[model samples]
Target chain A: MAVSVLPQMKQAPEMNPVERLMAATAADMARVNDLILDRARSHVDMVPELARYLIDSGGKRLRPMLTVAAAILFGRGQGHAVNFAAAVEFMHNATLLHDDVVDESDMRRGKPAARMVWGNKASILVGDFLLGQAFMMMVETGDIEALGVLSAASAVMAEGEVFQLAKTGDLETSAADYAEVIRAKTAVLFEAACAVGAMSGGADAAGRKALALYGLELGNAFQLVDDALDYGGQSGTLGKNVGDDLREGKMTLPVILALEAASDSERAIIASALGKPDATDLEVHQVVAIFNRYDTLRRTLDKARDHAKAAIAALDSLPDSEMKTILADVVQHSVSRAS
Target chain B: MAVSVLPQMKQAPEMNPVERLMAATAADMARVNDLILDRARSHVDMVPELARYLIDSGGKRLRPMLTVAAAILFGRGQGHAVNFAAAVEFMHNATLLHDDVVDESDMRRGKPAARMVWGNKASILVGDFLLGQAFMMMVETGDIEALGVLSAASAVMAEGEVFQLAKTGDLETSAADYAEVIRAKTAVLFEAACAVGAMSGGADAAGRKALALYGLELGNAFQLVDDALDYGGQSGTLGKNVGDDLREGKMTLPVILALEAASDSERAIIASALGKPDATDLEVHQVVAIFNRYDTLRRTLDKARDHAKAAIAALDSLPDSEMKTILADVVQHSVSRAS
Candidate 1:
């Protein structure tokens, strides 16, 4: 009999791609978690409280995972990967705190956003607190070159947010411009995280560059799928409702693609709803129809697949290892899971 | 007006304390200024645009001035001090941006606050950008020890801010707590700025420690005067009305001292106005009278003077030089000018 087919499949030896990596890296991830919790403590009550509130939430900790995984694949050095992994998580969480405030989001990780609970001032200040701590952690390693990689990424990430802000709802945003935004905002940190993690693990320059590229492509694919999801994905997958990016005036990839191919009347329909904070579900439905007509969502997924392929391809030159395959599958699955 | 006494006094050779030091370090300060303006340029238009807006405002540039002065006092190293000086200014400005967002300040240097102009989101993100730049600059120097100094100071500064936020309007906040808050929030940056500058200039360990102590005392004196000025200084001195600290519920030295000596009725009056955002000027006047009754303003200023003297005395071990003497006077003037 069709005896709980879904539960049976879940119990199969082959687990979900992400869950597999989670298991493979579980010990190191646990250590990273410990490092995160330890570093978050502070004399100021609000500092630790707010930091842990966000850090302990349902975040998958993918960036830190990538950092730790990359370090393990190289397998060298005095185990600075733990600190670097924690720092990467802190940077990612810090950005989320600021992003929620910037986007005026009400939720994060399917829970009330930190800004919603603590207010914008606390969120911003806490974000700065996290960043300061991240730098301190990085400095404690006494690895100047690796610190340069991360700091450079931090600057670029801020530039990206500003660039996105400038282009928000500007309907004139191009694919090239959209690529730059996601690259800076999303991929650069990923690139730096993996690169620095590898550096700390004593990876050679070539190996470091390969991991950096792998992370960059994975991040691009990940964010491209994220933008696509806002137009047409499961209702609750994004922590916010569908079309959240459009409502926030963000010029995501799908919107840019659909805008490029739309006729004047269709363009008016999309532009009318874009960047309107009060955009209704009906308006979102209408935008999705336009996206459907243009096949922008499918095309966005296709683009994501391309990046995922490139991310996997980056590992071709490296010696094959169990961790390397998991890293490649993780990159591919980062996109597929959004389907 | 018989002899136009004001003009005659203005024409005297003696310059304003800050101005005299500015002139003494004009070349180095100019180099720092150039570096600041140059590094502040960014591809993200909002970054450079917003950074320049605040950087060009008529700040006294006191922090960077101190940084360069400390560097020049030692007079060595093909001048990493310029970068450190710029980094110091960036750190100070970064704090100012976040502080305005936290304080909801509407004005800075007689201009609308960055948050007021660009909104809190821009101010916060831009502040992060500046800090990222600050760290990048510090890292570029490849001096891990100094980076450690600045990073440690940054963490303490954020912690101090959180501590102050926690203590806001709490009548139980103590004199020791207030000192800790000020030392962390204000004095630590000053300490780090001078220490790093001294290090960049090739100062010995003893010399570095001396500059650090000197800067810490000077910063304590500077903030003490700033707090005292909030209660009793001239118009426009704080870029806001007198007793702002009271309206904001800040437990400044004057308020703490008054709380200790206050009669029940007087304490009730202060409790009513403290931390009340809508506190009336009349209420502020009442608090000031109580402060006057206890000589708290004078006592606060006296505390500032003592710290300022200690700051100068810390430099006594250093060899005599024009820059050294100017630095000593600078500390004294930091307090006397408030009087």
Candidate 2:
């Protein structure tokens, strides 16, 4: 459990990429956290209680940090970036809460899932509450264009969830479909977070586009690494069991590639294990054996490296700053975590 | 089954209040409906399917009509009222979708609830989608003040729901608490609907205040009538069974008043039925008998009548117009439905 997501980065003599980024944006992110917790307050006790349970549950606040770091990278924001950062985090956490309910997850961040403790209905409603607050925060920023970006992402995220739901356990789900799913559900928010942050910093259109593209590619790499880690990491290393994605019928890159190369007998073993909530450990071993044989985990990591490279390349237009170096390192760490 | 909500108005041989209002705003309401249906479209099949299932379900588009009617009263929206009206409807349907999931109701509007058909997870996510789309519509209007009104209402409505959830079946919930709950959960949206419509319509400060007050009182009266009808009306009268509020442990005004007057034996019976989701029909009848003994339904109707009167009184500041008359009449009809 003490093993960080990017253990190698922790071993680096310099500060970890995530830690360096957090330190760079520490002041703004602190303000954003305050704004988030303040907005989370409501006369209805349960609204705040359920919301803070997840907001305070040690999420690394990575999305909001990106917003803040992007804002600082561009220069001093007019101060609206703090609100946008908080809004981004709220949107991310809101999706997570609802996702846990949809996936019927029992744990999150090494603790009981919000749905497990509060029930699915509460989790769902509270998720709606957080989303409402997110919009409220965005409106406070008074940037209609930024609001459009976030709202569009919000809609696409829900679509991604539905598409994923429809494709659950289907071996026929293409690599392209998985890409579309992750792009919508995960990358859109990241793209919005950085784009809005750039806007708050008075970045011109070109800068905003560059930051958005950077966030998008980083998000892609982050998710690809996460998918790979689900298969390769030790239990509790990722706050879930290895093969959890397979058990949940998620069509991650590793599984997609493994299925592509699997022989008929190996395919049968994978099919039986995929999407079976009660998939057994031996079945998982059999699937992993095939995954190892085909080196699909390495292929997945390779795909993540490709995304990480593109993420850094997307930052080529940005002016040099200490934050820029950390941002590129963050991209590298996103893929390195899986390795 | 042929009974209309405003039965007394129907007896007058002219168009009933809702019909009159809808006819008055026919052109605008049509545009609003088109916008709503247009916004509901998505590449994700279930997103539109579940969203449309509820939007197309049989219920008067009362909230959107109120928005359009309010806008027309002041007559200066420049077509933005259509957007606000569509946004209002989307918000209302979004809440209904989530409410059904939280309450676990099997039916809505004479058909199976979307949750029953599509399951709770889809209902929740799709509801979130509608909410996101609602905000998008509102932002597109470029009305910043109006956006704030709706977003604030959005947060308050969620808080209201949480309060209602917290107080469910806690028999000692006071009349004041019940009043706050309904005001937040039901009336704030109504107030916002009209206020935003008036804002978009360019209503003067005095006229906007009057419309907001009118809408709030109308909302209060409408919800009180609904609570009374839940116990007093026949099955299917309100797209649900009699005593559903009791079975769900909703502390509606009628039940709140009844509990205040119940004898110890009656109180014990009500307690057993309250929040007991599996309570039988016989149990409902027993609770209703006690409600009859206390005249709680009548008292609830009387309270609604008081609010309806206040609603009409609030509209006195509005200059005379057909829309003004119909709006006042709509207030009366909101209560008369329970009669």
Candidate 3:
């Protein structure tokens, strides 16, 4: 088949909120990236290799960008934001590496997981290495308050994961349980990242609290959208297989909502594929159809929009700036991904 | 079978070096134990369940004991020693949990490993929870320097594990490589534990360095004896199967020495079992015969003795006290375990 080319007028690409935030925080993020690679170096070649592979892979680096942006919003960091931002990213990556092993996941950020390339043992050890490095960086900053924030968040994140693991595949998992899981596993880090960044930039108590709330709400929106995308979006857009959450037996919000509204037979159809790792595409579609009947995806996205609105509202008390506008826009864009 | 009872005369039980250290540090250790249990508590039942199972299992809390002993030797510490000691134990337990997962181990401290009871996913998350709690405890103490010591040690320990994993099953692994592995994986934590304890206890630079060196050499001796006992000890004595090191393909000093001295046929016999997960008892016996022919176990124990001596010698410049004497005796006893 021959393809025909048509002449088109040139236009400048419009930057998304995340892209705008990235441009705004480019200098600090560059430093964060440099610090990440530098601190990731190890004499044990595999440590650096595995770490670099994951670090260089296409993560948006949004968490660290938030750290930098929050710091810029307060406008007083004496180069400490770079260290905090890098440490946050490392903590995030460490979690990702361990999460893959726990979930026995094959792909991450559109590439084969570190576990696949280096085996589960290496993945576990390197994840540990990165976590250690994260703490070490925090210690170097000699900001014990910030260290405490991150450490407490770390503990809560692990608890969230354990709680999520315990609730996996349980049909009775509630929206409340899902909220707790997302809060612990995902939003807590976001809260810590922004809180610490604000602290680094010498924010007042109110400013710090505002950024923390903003981050927490934004994180909720981020994860809610992600869960919705697992069923509503294409695999290409999500960088993972569609219905993976179902295959993994995760009682995500959509599934939880569908179960609550499902008929007995409809529930059975969804349950047939809920925790079955080998569930076929047809089985997933069956489950998705049930979800559609209940309008769970739209409901989940609606919940995400609520969180995004709250996230934007959090910045109302802070002084208005370009970064602030972009941050609010980022929250809106995050929830829009599914739609 | 009938058992016979014999009349026994009453006698005072002599305390071993470790027992003496434990007794001397009992007050501080009580607080440490309390802290450990308190921190290990999580709302997630499995987190506490798995963590408690591992924590309550019968392993001599030697690492934390060293932390307390080092602090007492300096004659100072305003309750900070308890926190440090608990943190050290948590770090050790975290490493053990992850190690069991990475090694696919079934037994630990004569009990089924945590992974066996709760599965690898729970083990990994619980391990992370413990590590996070450890840092939180350190942060609570407001001692950034001590935190730095443990954090750096944690990184080095992870690197050591990665390096050891890379060297597994390699017959050409040398004595130097084995030493590097032990120092990084085992000795560094010991060094950090003692060093941090001394710092918390207000020790001078000289005193801190002395404790660090003492701990490092003791750790080296501890690991060497452990490796040797894998070949020479009864399963009951070691709390694990004999020949476990060989079965796991660990390039310990004994294996390095045996390979160095083995002939072509002998090397083949050893190779057949090295890294073989299901290596039979007969295969282990054949390999042990080669080790015996080379006196590798005795030589390995001899190396342990050398390290024990150096550990004792590291305390020479310190002011003599009951704790110091017990610390020296503890090193001797650690190396004497294989014999």
Candidate 4:
């Protein structure tokens, strides 16, 4: 008798690093999200309405997840991590709202920006409201050291934005300046997030420092990948139009490197598109062609990979754990987004 | 012998209450100013440049003086008051920068606004920087209770501004709504400044509550007078043009009162100029005439006087001191500006 043919065993696809981290920290993230939504409420209709629009918009919530993951890595149950995570998210969203207004961005998170739906005045006020709420949340935690870390980070972030604004469209921007800008505006917050999470998680000084370093390096890699993606990635993936950084006169590393290597004629083409609000698609493509010709995008991505490696190296001293492994892999996934 | 004619002794001019408060808090205020200037410094040149412009532009520093004076009133010498005072000033200036952008006013403190010189984008970013620094200073103090007070006040102030924006040019805005708006936007910061100062100054729970109540009423009176002065006071003294509130469609007390009393035609005249950016001097005058006919300006000032009295009454339980007297008189001085 012929044996019944057995159904072929199907293989389950492996989860990406971010997805794995999310699943591992899902319980803590739910509490963090609850705190975030609760704190975002206001008596004023516009405050919450505008805030909800931004908060509900689909963001990966990666920063807060890092906070949770770092806490779990230290074997501490969620204590003040929930509050710290929520505050970190609020600060991040606050900056995003202000940045959109500053950049005159048309879209955010695959949706029309809050400023587009509400006016710029509403965007500014609500951003201020969110920032105020962020500090209030931190104050509620009664963790003075953590508060200091986050507050200092907030100041440095603003300084970074101001410095970046000052250097916009300037061809003379150096790699050093770009490094400083990214460190101040982007990496510091990440460092603060991880450091504070570790503090709340009962990590000792060494552990906190390691997490901070990991966060800083990861943030650097994340921003570099973002800069590369602005030129090399698709618009659908970016949630923003391709070439936006170039159109906004932002001197991202890709543009800076290209400007350094291009001929005078090629530099002129890039300049015409740089900071020109009305820059046509053709002009943007011409500039991108120059970037590709010099392999600046690839060079930028390579620099990102270096930071990603550094980020993983920061965790080497920690005892092996699933959370630690996930955190290291997450850095790799962040850099790999450009591919 | 001819009697020697003696020059008549000239009586010294009486110092206004504000002047008296300034004198009493001079030493502490000097420290506060130093702290303000120091914290305002940033590696980003534009940050300090814009911050200094606003800080040095000669605001009376009333809010910070209240803080120092409150601390001194409770005989706390000057521990964290200096930092709190500096932070209060920064918050005020931050709001002013943002308010100017929201109002699109060309002048501030009788000079071109920082936004005019630096652009709205700079004003926004610098305001953010100052706000971040404000929190940083508070965090440095390590007084979580004080920080909580200021941060909660910050959230309320933002809510107030958002509420005010929502009601802009809405004729149906009631007097109660106006009260809520002023309290949230203006009075809450004053209340917080005094309460925090008292806390830092070693005030017990009862003493802190008294100072807070005094501040809330004083703030109410202060804002009411400001609303009246926008119509009744001169541009030179107000540091802002007359009829600005009306032109911007701010539903201040006078406008709200006038709207309630107006006939259809009179309301029509006011409506034509309300929120009209290009509203001519003639139109503003016509609206003012209606305000005059309705006695709305006087009525508004009368309400301010009531609140001023209430403010002084709140201090009745506190022991008499020179600072207390100065604080009481300052409330009167603030209201008298409308007259």
Candidate 5:
């Protein structure tokens, strides 16, 4: 419950690139918190209660900071970058509220989710309000091109949510199906944030395309890692329990791919575990053990690493800058985050 | 249950002056039914079961017809009026789906609501998908001003929903509060549609302003009439029972205003009916008798007339054409709809 405020340039732990990346993320996230988020939230008190409640509950703020970093990398580091950055963050929170209602999630970021605090109806409406506000803020940019990207991304995000709703709990789902879901649900906004920043900063079409590619790959990797963690990572480190995805009956990429490669007996056990009215801890442990023997975690991590590398490759066209380094660092960190 | 198609030239008997003005509205409504609503629902076959479940249950396409009539009157008589009109209708449907979930209503338009058929979670997500699609359709307009106005209105509508959530079941509501609620809940988008149509047609600032004014007044009157009817409109006519609003504890305009005007004995009776766990038919009848004695319905209808006149006044700046005449007719007809 104790919140710590650490300096930006903290030392990295040995043997884990995650520490350095977390430290960088912490620094960048802090700037967004201090500069834009806190200020915008305070401007309107009543509704911002939920916005701040969701935002400050220890989210990575990776998307908004990426927008800022992208702007800086492209040599237009000031002006609407912060605003657009907040807009992206708001969009993320909006999705989270609706997702929690849809998923019936009670906790998020180690705190009770919005639906838990305010009920599903409030959470849903507030989520809608946040999305609208995000669009309104983006309109202030006066750049129709940016508007087009963000609006389209917003549409894609909603579609992704519906797609997930349609697909979740279905045993027939494949890794490709999961990939499609993740790409729309999580990655598109990240891609939009970076692309909008590049385009807004006057990046050429090729540069904007490259940035978008990097963001998409990076976001995909981040979600892949998240899916893997949901399947096997330590609860203490991950902020979620291993096998949470199974209990929720969600067929994430790792689970689907692992199921594809599992032996008949393993698949039977997995299916039975998923079919439980309320999956018991022992059943979850059994499924986890099967996944462990198959090295599903390792395979998932490797795929995530490949995506991260692809993200880095996408950034090769950018002129070297502090932000570019940070952007690349974010991709690595995204894949490595335990939570 | 049988519907008879009426030609524009041959008006129905009960049609008033406003209905006469809105003759083209009837035709436009039919056009919308064919070109947009039917096709839009047909495309829902992609989801097959869920789509069939939602669209097969009928909905009144009031919002879209309003848009079409306003657009035509405001000089947007050609080029994708159907699309924009459908966009508004889609928005209306989206709101209805979400409202059913929030209100936990079982029936709408004489059948099971979307949530009742598919579950609240699906209805909520599909509502979101519909809303997103509406935005996409609006974007297809390529009118920045139109986008801005609709986007702003959408935001207000979301905020209104939130406001309603925040105040739900609270009996301390006032007439002014109720007005504020309706303004956000129903009027803004109506205003935006007229504004967008005028703007699209290259109407001057005065003309656009007039259109907006007309929309605001008409929407206000329409909502007021709806609330009044909800209090006592015959089921055979309005397809709704009297006292449904009171039973739901909606705190609508007539009830709020009526409560303020109630004598001490009347207030006690009204309070008892509202406070009861299940208000009996006799209790509702008593409340209705009190309302009739207080002339609450007449007062509300008078206010509606004032708004109707104001909407007509707002359109005075537009060039006099058949479409303009029809738009004016819509205002009169909207306030007088029996069902």
Candidate 6:
């Protein structure tokens, strides 16, 4: 069965819910981030040099930005939302640093990884430091709901990574398992980012639910397309090499489905390739060829579009606002953008 | 300038404070752990598996046990001290798993490292999962004071690892620098554990400070003796391999002093030895002989004794209670034990 891609949002700038929501509260969001970075200075002094090294590396600040954006979408433009956003970003960065160490990865955002430059121990500990900072920041917010949401999301994120590790080389991973992993590892934070934003703004039940759904769907769309791009060349768009996931032995959507449909010989090749810790680039190329033969890349792209459309539908239930329109643009970008 | 070892408390079975404290909170602590673990089931299903892998791996669970002991000692035994203890233990294990991955260590507690068993990614992510579990457990305690203390301590622990990494193999590291590292990496948690225990038991400011100091000194003593035993080669008492620190290129108390006191030729030899992390056991033995010649091992052991006495002194201002007295005994054990 072929799935249709969502048409690109041509009037996205004018109609995007996320953009409208963000435009309304961009200044406050910036202020909240400044406050967070200021407070982060206290605990960060223990490794002043390294902490500065990472903080200066420049991040997208997407999680916190989304948190603030969600708050504005819910008609809540307050400082607490910004604090929670900063905390969310801290948690995200902590994981990134730790992940880099665990993966023995050398680069991040075209720069040397914290571990590569500072050594693995520094990266690992600094990651832990960021996590501690996150909790402390959340506790000070004094919102039991926010604390519950963030902490619970963090637990899921950790669990998701462990689950992914356990299943990485296993070709038997199903679409459901893949979906669950994305939810646990990525989307839950997105959901919480919006939920916390709504809570901070004191949104109505409908508003809260709508923002949560929108964030989840958007995250799903983003990760699904990400998985697909690894099977096809999308470096110009995604800023990463093609077949990176296969090289990492990740049982992502295209690979999982393609393997399911593989001929006996193809299956044997994949099974052997997946078993190894470091699969060769030639093996990755062979896997990508199998994906192409099965139209696996196209199928995954279709799923991503479905998720993006579902995300847009979620916003349809919310009060029509500028922030809502920007959100629509975000969903559009999730499946369409290169990087 | 021989440093005298603290006399080990020669008490009857009934006089064993560690055992007594362990017994007092054993059931409640276990039950509370059940509660925290239950909450984790839906959020972190992989945790039960990972926790079993780690907890069954023969770790002493010393930190959590001390937390419970401290709670009982402070007379605030009715609350979530057990969960707090469990949280601290989880944090400690997280560090262990990540540390093994960072150091590329093959052995822990006389067994294979987690990375060796499950691979680096699994070890790292599982470590992260344990940390998240710690945070989740802390959320259940619902005490901001306890939350703040643990959070700050966690950050210090991370920073300490970075500082330690940065200073590793550097001959210029001072005693003050070494002290700061241990304090951040190990003692802060010990201090926080006791402080959280006091908070749990509703202990006053004075009581909390006293216990915190006691734990801090105990940690310092413990680390100092640990370093000394690495050089002293009193294997019967230290259980761990002698000069393991030197083999790992770790700069410890004896080595720091030895470098300072060495003749220029000897200093160059030491520096060159540290350059090769893959040094043979014979090479390690050669380094130990050098330390022996300089009396660096003896001097370091003396310094450890001083810290042990200081640890006991920190408890002197506390109220006269059996638990308090037992805590003092533990402080002495901190220095006297071989491993």
My TM-score estimates for the predictions, one after another, are: 0.95, 0.95, 0.96, 0.96, 0.88, 0.89
Tens digit of per-residue lDDT, candidate 1, span B1-339: 312311222322568767777776677788889989988888778888899999999888888888877887787455788888899899889999989988988888878998888888788888888988999999998988989998888878888888898899999999899999999999999998899888878899999999999999999998999898888746476676687788889999999999999999999999999988889989999999999999999999999988888899999999987678778988877788776
| Two-chain DockQ for each candidate model | 0.63, 0.63, 0.74, 0.70, 0.42, 0.47
Q: In CAPRI terms, where does candidate 3 land?
A: medium
Tens-digit per-residue lDDT, B203-264, candidate 5: 77887788888888888888888888877556556656677777766777666766888898
Instruction: Specify the poorest-scoring 10-residue window by lDDT in model 1 chain A.
Output: A1-10
Checking candidate 5 for backbone clashes, the offending pairs are: B18-B332, B21-B329, B22-B329
Pick the winner on lDDT between candidates 2 and 4. Answer: 4
lDDT of 3 by residue, B1-339 (tens): 001110121222498888877777877888889989899998888988899999999878999989988887887566588899999999999999999999999999888999999999989998999999999999999999999999999989999999999999999998999999999999999999999888988899999999999999999999998888888756897678988988999999877898998889999999999999999999999998888889988998899999899999999999777778789989988887777
What candidate 2 gets wrong by more than 4 Å, as runs, is A1-13, B1-13
Error of 2 at B284 (Å): 1.2
Candidate 4, clashing residue pairs?
Answer: none
For every candidate in turn, the CA RMSD to the true structure comes to 5.6, 4.9, 6.8, 6.1, 5.3, 6.3
* Candidate 1: stretches off by over 4 Å: A1-12, B1-12
Residue A13 in model 3: lDDT: 46
Please provide, for model 6 over B1-339, each residue's C-alpha lDDT reduced to its tens digit, 9 standing for 90 to 100. Answer: 001111222335764555655555566567655754564354445567655666666655667767776776666555778778888887888888877776667777766776787777777777777778787788876776688888888877877877777787888989888889888888898888888887787778887887788778778777887888776666545445665677667778888888888889888878877746677777777777788888887777787777778878877887666666667777766666643
Predicted complex 6: DockQ: 0.47
Residue A292 lDDT, candidate 4, scale 0-100: 89
**lDDT, candidate 4, B205-308, per-residue tens:** 99999999999999999999989989875889878989899999999989899999999999999989999988998999999999999999999999999999
Q: For model 6, how does the per-residue alpha-carbon lDDT over A124-221 read when each residue is reduced to its tens digit?
A: 77777788878878878777667877888888888888777768787788888889889888888888888898888788788788888888888888
lDDT of 3 by residue, A1-339 (tens): 001110121221498888877877877888899999999998888999999999999899999999998998887466588888999999999999999999999999889999999999999999899999999999999999999999999999999999999998999999999999999999999999999999998899999999999999999999999999998757897679988999999988999999999999999999889889999999999999998999999999999999999999999998777678778889989988988
Winner by DockQ: 3
lDDT of each: 0.86, 0.86, 0.89, 0.89, 0.72, 0.74
Q: How would the docking of model 4 be graded?
A: medium
Ranking by DockQ: 3, 4, 1, 2, 6, 5
Docking class of 1: medium
Model 4: DockQ vs. true structure: 0.70
Model 2 / residue B82 / CA error / Å: 1.0
Candidate that beats the other on TM-score, 1 or 4, i.e. the better one: 4
Count clashing residue pairs per candidate: 0, 0, 0, 0, 3, 26
